[model samples]
Target: MRRPLSLFLSAVALMMTATALAAPHPVPLSELFPNSGHARSAIIINKVLERYHYRKVKLDNAFARQVLAKYLAALDPNRAFFLARDVERFENGARRLEENLRRGELDAAFDIFRVYRMRVDERVAGALKLLDGQFDFGRAESYAFPPSSASSPSTARWAQDSAELDELWRKRVKNDFLTLRLAGKADPEIRERLQKRYEGLARRIHQFNGDDVFQTFMNAYTETLEPHTSYMSPSTSENFDISMKLSLEGIGAVLRGDNEYTVVQSTVPGGPARESGQIHAGDQIVGVAQGLDGALEDVVGWRLEDVVDKIRGPKGSVVRLQLLSKSSGSTAQTREVSLVRNEIKLEDQAAKTFVVDPLANAPGLKIGVIEIPAFYRDFAAEGAGNQDFRSTTRDVRKLVEQLVAQGVDGILIDLRANGGGSLAEATSLAGLFIDTGPVVQVKDNFGKVEVETDTDPGVAYNGPLAVLVDRDSASASEIFAAAIQDYGRGLIIGEPTFGKGTVQTLIDLNRYVPGEHNDLGRLRLTMAEFFRISGGSTQLRGVEPDIRFPGADYLTNHGERSLDNALPWTQIKPADYKRVGQVSVDRLAQQSAERIAQDVGFRMLTERSKLMRDAEAQTQVSLRETERREEDKRRERAFKELQNRFLQARGITPVDEDADQIDEDALDAQRKAIARIEVDEAARILADRILMERERQPRAVMKD
Candidate 1:
């Protein structure tokens, strides 16, 4: 059975050739948008970071290794592109990265990126080839989506001539086709759509210029320091300015990349997407199209900026989006929505007040709710000395006065989904409730602590006040809430706030080096941290609510602590502040918790949240059509049952089992109704507090 020596040698030679072919070919790096001031820019950035960054870490050899790993991870996070050998090659320059950075030499970074580009090209080509073969729907196969528990292949595993990688890609394409097929797409349509999606990926890679690579590399560097600190390229700086102005003509949704899908982060209150009520946070946008008659373009693997460009258009124009419902059991369920673009008016973000009737048992008390979307201020107008400039503090103060005039018994400041804005506004707003005291503490990079105090001695309206905050309330929101809570001015209700307390100062790179015509991007450097009056740093542990609600799935991944590089929580000396309110949060929390335990809607929400968490934890998805369909049915049943329970609790008409074709308006109404239920619960909690306060007062004092 001995084989000939020449035959064995021939087989070994063929295997070696296959391995070499599988290894990615390095693409030559070119200097595009050559900046003569790169070395100067790097030196200035390093100097500023070392001098002013809050962390105050040295950029030594150890730090260089971390940066090297971070850069590689940034480029190939999923381990689907660059091979292990490429990573090893890049590691050879790791120790020298710090020295190179000090000298403004980015050759190693550029070399790594060039290899990444080549790997992307190779992978895309391989993926496209997989689409040519027929997939077996009956086969028991699965695709492990990202954040998978499985580790990446080693260099030796990758160098092997086995068909494992090809099989993995084949399964991926098959999964894509299966999802579309379940969504009612025919075979031909599915193939064509997937082909376009893959082609778009290659096209986007091919279109990457030097500025894009530099931006990516710089972001990797800054983000390694902290999550919030970032470097914005010149073009991105302009976009940031536009966003701050809130005048961009688009659907008004903040989109972020999650794996291969573009997910809706949040919708502007007055934007087309929010008004239409068709889009929601956590929904995945798979395809986009132009006006009414445009063909649907698959945007699964498109760049985030490219997708954003397609979504934005002139005011009054229509743009269509095809979305995969996050709530749906299967990704196959989709809906198409068309929205008319419009400007996000300042009025939409302004503070507004409304009256809510007392709880079912307590009928006489009327509660006022003031919704503050963001801690906004017209800085330009204010700087120009416009006495009537709009700001969150001024607007909220007026709303409070208006509510008091309306004879409301209590007031609730709703800060749900209020991502914090101006810190000045937050302090001024807190002053409206408190007479005069320290609002927040700021600790700079050099260990210098400064107390931000409210100089105003007049309280606007301090009657039975309550501040409601959810996980989205952050930074300035936390500042205001903490001040109010520390002074015992209001009850903090709802979920814990988002834990982002660091202060970022923008450094214009061009200013550091004069006579440099190149457009050097700005650096958003975290130079300070915020602390509550109670001395606790709101870095990772946000302000905990007095009364907690059912857990939300979004909280699993959307908190400051979820970020790997987020700053840690610490404490300092507590600021001096006197308690002004007599309300007992502990008793109120107990009452609310009891009520929630008995509430069927809350119970249903809790169960649904658990199901969502379980679903998200699942990494592998079946490719078999029958199994997928069964799973889909199970998920639909669970969702509908939860919906029915919520409706039953509210005494609203439950949706019929066979009534699957609900109109868009009906769906919007349902969503609003669900939201109203939560608001109603919050109002009831305030009502309970009002009644308790009434019971505590002396009869003579009450009559006065």
Candidate 2:
């Protein structure tokens, strides 16, 4: 039912992997009130969470208070709109929230939203007025707006009065103008763009309907339980269903709201965005446009769904994006990327193999690399009993045999940006490297445990093996990585995984109340959790690498651990399994550490990681035009030097920043310089691992 593996791997190689408001015409908005069905929906959601959510939370005063806190944070993550007094006014309502929820009363939620709407209207008005006046960029001052999330609200002080809030808006408007100015826009263009952007922000706020309010408040309630657990309004539910049922015809990137920005979580293989080799996870999408000639829509503070609609369009359509690269940190300059929308194909995500030719320094030690974007399976074909059914294990099994035939010394499964897929494939894939044994343990809310084991006894390829993972690796990815690490069958490398161990199932709220319309929406509830064979849960503490890369520590405030109320790391009884004890991690780690210390690319990566962290930590930025310009230029110059150093080492000429055109191969060379630092290093480590294993083997002596 799917394409053949040979065809999918024909070119097997190394892997690397918002809407705008239409018119200036403002829509008349009325005070949003909860719909008639919202009350019943809220009550039903409360019941579902209480009975089935993996992290069982009581609906008492403490939880009620937490939900209120989460709600406020969700609405005003930047502390730009709501005042301190507005937040205090809701404290008493917070105490009564849970009781009201059980009684199907949502007035408290609606009340807070009304106040938020009012504050937004006021703030945007102030920002618009500030745009009329000239800003003295020569004067030295700094604008501060540290990023915030639902789990962590802004730690900065909230304005006490209207006058203080107006001043905050003044700085905000100035920052916007300066940002545009720095991007090389003229003063008039900056003003017009800022005006439209601010107007769009105000227009979107007024367009909020009852459904949006209900869904937002409900998510605030559910997200406090777990980040994955959420409530979708009917309209959102429809979009979710469409995306799940068919190939999404748009930029195939998963996005989430981080503070006021829409941050890309991961890119789907075969999608335009992924294939373009531009957009990436953690990149903040600031602006989106329909075509080459269309006006760019500033989507900074727009709703996630509205922004999504602007990006998604018919196949063959061109969508342009202004992205703030995740690796570039918060203060970096934005880059424009153009992508043609297309359907994300199934074959694009299929496992493919690449034979890394042994480096000159390490000849006769070829390491085969298998880049799996996702743990995918053709469920329809499998259910229909198709013998040639496509699956991760089947594809990987074929690739492993091919690699062995190529006489590679070792193999590395690259799961760097893989967000995981089929669960069964994770189990079957583990069986390829290890003898029959338990792969992973699953536990339900009732504490009943189910163990999925490898039934086959024959090994596919059992030589030196390692798994490469990053913070984006999750779910089934963690399962396979954990199994390999537990059985001592392979080495785990890269940063810690995404740490999302819980499973979620969607429940239709319409089914709960018979005769009710399907407009009741749905609740995605976490029902089960995953645990390693060695008794540890991969919930918040994802599988740790045996030999971690340099930048792993700096990314601690990411993945599942960053979510509020994420289930803590727990353990169950160890499953029955024997260890192979094939790896000598200590010696390999020491060798890898030494190489990392001297590697120029690794050194650059470490600095960039630290720079990103430092940028995130900074609460202020200079508004003085010359000072800010110089500061940004210095950062850019330093990065260029790091890149040039790598080029110079490789005997290639360094590229000038002011070059009118860059050779495609040179661009590839530059990418190779930075991206392959880890990939090529991982190969060297595997090469060392292969030698270590050989040394452990008994010497064959001639008996004359």
Model 1 clash pairs are none
lDDT comparing candidate 1 with the true structure: 0.74
Question: For candidate 1, what is the TM-score?
Answer: 0.89
Model 2 residue 165 lDDT? Answer: 81
| lDDT measured at residue 206 in model 2 versus the true structure, 0 to 100 | 77
Deviation in Å, model 1, residue 602 alpha carbon: 2.1
Q: Clashing pairs in model 2? A: 19-307
lDDT of 2 by residue, 1-704 (tens): 01111111111100111222354333344547776799989989998888888777799988888888889888888788888888888986666887888987888888898888778888888888888888999997898875556567646767798888887888888988888788777999888888888787777877777888898999888877777788888976765555455544677777777877887767777777777777777788889988887888888887776667677777778889988866655456778887888766678889888877856547877989999998888888879989898888999999999999989888999988887778888999999999999999999877789999999998998788989998888889999999999888888999999898887777899998998865899887778889999999988889999989989978857877877778889999999999986566898889899988988888788878876677667678888888878877888878778877877887777755345676767666666566667878888888887777678789999898
- TM-score for candidate 2, residues paired by index: 0.93
Candidate number achieving the greatest lDDT relative to the actual structure: 2
**Each candidate's lDDT (Cα)?**
0.74, 0.79
Worst 10 residues of 1 by lDDT: 1-10
